[model samples]
Target: MTEAAACGIDGVDTGLADPPLLVADGVTRWYGHRLGCRDVSFRLWPGEVLGIVGESGSGKTTLLDCLSGRLTPSDGTVTYRTAGGETVDIFSRPEAERRLLQRTEWGIVRQNPRDGLRMGVSAGANIGERLMAAGGRHYGRIRALAGEWLERVEIDHDRLDDRPTTFSGGMQQRLQIARNLVTHPRLVFMDEPTGSLDVSVQARLLDLLRGLVARFGLAAVIVTHDLAVARLLAHRLMVMQQGAVVESGLTDQVLDDPQHPYTQLLVSSVLQA
Candidate 1:
């Protein structure tokens, strides 16, 4: 193989040979003197989904923000391993590099669609914005990509030009998923992606998410207050309480026989179909 070909994924140039996609070592985030994830450490690999479940105020969102580079850890390192196998600490990176990764590679979806989306913009534009940041500005490419993601997320492509205001809470959440997934990110951080939707809508969206996540082979960190969400989408589950991971294991084991009291309570709350 040619030197260039050797460095690429089917000539696509994905840097997966070295460094975890995102890594947190003793990472901690603070909110007005409150500790979040005190000395938290974990590694997220490509194509793996790690579920973070905790009650409110358990620091799930704080950990996601720290890993996504939106919040700098108070006393730890957030490292990003590049496509070329260079590892740079996210908090310590120069502003330019950090901005590039934040805009291009990382995808974050929040509990409230309004918080994550541009309500004034059309759904297509919202999805296209990420592509524009990733250096795709040509109208055709952006629209085509947006349409594809819209369909992928089960949104009707015909509504591409419609503003988010026309959609229901479920549709808005689906649009947000499309917006984030359109970037083809390697790691996605979703904070309660379906929290606002009805149970029926949540089930459909959850199924769509599972398929899309597998099809793209993307790694994810999902935070949810719903135990069922953790059971549905996670390969591994990390149960947290008061800013610390108390129990972690394969999702089935963790759900089937939760050893931790907190985990037991969490699992017990789930209702069978």
Candidate 2:
């Protein structure tokens, strides 16, 4: 892929000629009288990492939820291209089918590891359950894969029998990542993934995540308030403010030469910090 293709420059042919993995068009959500997000549209190609950045109440999380199918939009549609090469509107599909897509083809990494992890279960069980959901039934193979994933995420294999509740915050987050990626989902949705970690821990986790995403050729949509994280991980960026996308483009271009006033302010604040 060319730099233009990797950075998602508009009108630049990516050469792969493959259709987008996911598409969200005119997506809007309303909290009764208030707006959550409005008219958010984007195409996520395979292996692309798109970041959504904004401060609290900027509607980035709301947009992420709508795009990931955790919450249905009041208006607009979320369409996904299946592994079988069929495009389907997620909301229009049967609930079971939509859920099956989530379980088998899509992964969600919540901001809080606790929200994503089954804390009461053994760490090995957590990883194994996802494999089982995707049709793994052999106990020995499942156990082996779980151990392998733990090691891949830089966690000790011996921790497999332990519960997430007993692990440190960073370990729990790593375990959550292992569980999500064990199924090899084509796309992943992340919301404030490193938000709660200490700076050192967050940096290490980010490096791990970057490598894993590359190794798996995963497409991701990450929502975060931190521009530094966005710069590090995202190929393209969409800057949100006041429930709408104020600006969007290649990550470097938007961050380095912001076109919108709000985006400029955001960039300056990060530089000042």
TM-score of each model, in listed order:
0.89, 0.94
What is the lDDT for 180 in model 2? 96
Q: What lDDT would each prediction earn against the true structure?
A: 0.85, 0.93
Query: Which stretches in model 2 have alpha-carbon errors above 4 Å?
Result: 1-16, 271-273
What lDDT score goes with residue 237 in model 1?
Answer: 82
**Candidate that scores best on TM-score:** 2
- Tens digits of per-residue lDDT, candidate 2, 50-150, equal 99998999999999999988899999999999999999999998889988998899999999999998988999999999999999999999999999999
Error of 1 at 222 (Å): 0.5
lDDT of model 1, residue 10: 69
Clashes of 2: 0
RMSD, candidate 2, Å: 3.3
